[model samples]
Target: MFNEEFHLEQPIRWGMVGGGRGSQIGYIHRCSAQRDHLFQFVAGAFDVDAARGKEFGQNIGIAADRCYPDYKTMFAEEAKREDGIQAVSIATPNFTHYEILKAALEAGLHAVCEKPLCFTAEQAEELLALAKKNNRIVGVTYGYTGAQMIHQARRMIEEGMLGEIRIINMQFAHGYHSAAVEANDQGTKWRVNPKTAGPSYVLGDVGTHALFLAETMVPNLHIEKLLCSRQSFVKSRAPLEDNAIVLIQYDNGAIGNLWASCVNAGSTHQQKIRVVGEKASIEWWDEHPNQIVFAEQGKPVQILDRGQGYLYQDDEAITCDRMGGGHAEGLFEAWANLYRRFATAMDRVNHGEQASDVMNEMWFPNITDGAQGVRFIENCVRSADEGSVWVEYK
Candidate 1:
């Protein structure tokens, strides 16, 4: 049991599963978990292959005695230790999230799993059930939620600055599948596989991030109906569609457009979002993630940067700021902030600290976000499969 003072004063014990040498997302998670000084990687099974796992663990400075051969061994032995990981970071492929998270939860450890949550809606639901059954925390690292600017955007909308939100436009595009790589590049291979990554190519990959931001910020917006079209421009490049366009209708009579593609040339993660409302409008781009653009009648357009003091100070958003104003915080730090916030909350619970009435009001993305993300993917696929019919989400 750890108190708030004890928690921040001492690092939380943490472990990693997967993210061996050259694994793309694995490095990001590891870097993020280490950035805030809130977490310490006490153990890990960094690869599917035993030798590779040990090698990767050593490369990352994990002790050999603590780097076990498999997640099972790592979980079993760590549970016996008096000082074990308080949480585990799952950086494995999309398909492995459920199994790895289930194991961690069963071991009485909280989890920070990378996104898409599960390969299927059913699997995602089961994982949600398991988390409750084990009384463990499961947070999918939707890194954008950690951005200071995003918190500001959500605040502006929720505080009625954006009265009667009307529209959301979002796009996520990258030029990865077109680039040449190994025939079976472990990094690229699994992402393209349907069984592993689930439906709709870039939809689940970067699309989830876009959906998370728009839905989180816009008020009274729901995906009432969706019409989608998908394409695989690169000849059998990835089993999933390389490009997709989706049209959505919100329950509050608002509408949205989503465009995602992996085949787009010269676009290096050009993720952008725009929200329009009666009182104001806001826009954000992932390439310039630290800043948001705000426009409203009778006011000069404002550019809000992450980690800088906002026009309106929000403690939840402010706590995520690392350096002084003008210094930029990147994607990795955003992820770290989420973990730090989760640790702060869990530490309060561990020490018998009465939970804050507004803990749920904080910016961290929870299980509901996970469920909605999966639902969004499902809706996109259903629309595309049914000859681009406008399918209702519910």
Candidate 2:
């Protein structure tokens, strides 16, 4: 169970770049950051249009003067303030992430960025270097890993309950884009455009989420090589795949497969991961995030629920459970959990403490994880473009 009393003496003043009106992701970021009273929404460059951005900021109770027209202006003007924003969340298009995040770090502000941190691994590394040099925290939103059950799985695996891990299957397939919906949707439009979405569509978009989940659960496995096949089911979105499959060979001799698609007809967010070990296996589905299916080699299957006494209560991850057993908790809570960690990290830096000092006590996806996701996309695209042949994981 989460401790409601956990909070900072003063909430971290925060701002945003993008995620204006009608942006679902923007709204989610706001709700999650402010949910635990760890962060306070102080300002934003909410939209590309200056006038509309200022209006949206004021409409959401932010002062008119604080809402700048662009991130550059926001960073400049905020720096002069005694109560300037200490952190900012980058919720803009994928292509803009690297620049905005770079600017924020240079301004000495911590950041919470949407994933695939940048287009290339080189860019991701640059941002990582800058963050370290500036002593700022860069949080990548791999939101699902914050779920209490995920921590339980991690604890179980670490305890040797799963024995020698053999196979890992992961996927984040949905049917929302079975057709050319981007023809009518602006949000979806940018995603299918290489200029805005980066190298591979589904591979970087949904695939990274699933990949991070597997990484969080089985922390010991490292990809040795991989083979990838991708397709642009919606013809208009050529050069940007709407579906992709990746086969990974782990350094430990464990094999893994990832299926990421936006064309899984009739499905609704079928994001799942199943890890098989010599003695048992455990599976988790985002649709039913509260429970995990556990099957031992010789016993009947068992369903482990969140907040149950049987869970690894000693694990720090399990401490994120916001509600007791029967009540439901979903993406919002998971995101909030990540945000809370981000805040703690930022707060530590603010007090002249290293964010890594408390790593064993708390864990959150940092810049290194973000860089790895970008590299994974790079590898997948490399293999796919080279006639879908096996390639070394760089």
Candidate 1, residues 310-390: lDDT per residue as tens digits? 445635564445666677777876777787776765565456543332245454676657877887888788888889888
lDDT of 1: 0.77
Q: Weakest 10 consecutive residues, lDDT, candidate 1?
A: 1-10
Candidate 1 residue pairs in backbone clash: none
List TM-scores for all candidates, in order. 0.91, 0.98
Candidate 2, residues 1-394, lDDT tens digits: the string is: 7889998989999999999987859988999999999998999999999999999999999999998999999999999999999999999999999999999999999999998789998898898789878888889999998888988888888888889999999999999999999888999999999999999899888999999999999988999999999999889999999999999999999999999999999999999999999999999999999989999998999999988888877766786678888688999999998999999988888888875564444689988899999999999999999999999999
Considering every candidate listed, which one attains the maximal lDDT? 2
| TM-score of candidate 2 on Cα atoms, chains taken together | 0.98
Residue 101's lDDT within candidate 1 is: 80
After superposition, the stretches of candidate 2 with alpha carbons farther than 4 Å from their true spots are 356-361
- CA shift at 130, candidate 1, in angstroms? 1.9
Pick by TM-score: which candidate is best?
Answer: 2
- The total of clashing pairs for model 2 equals 0
**Global lDDT scores for all candidate models:** 0.77, 0.92
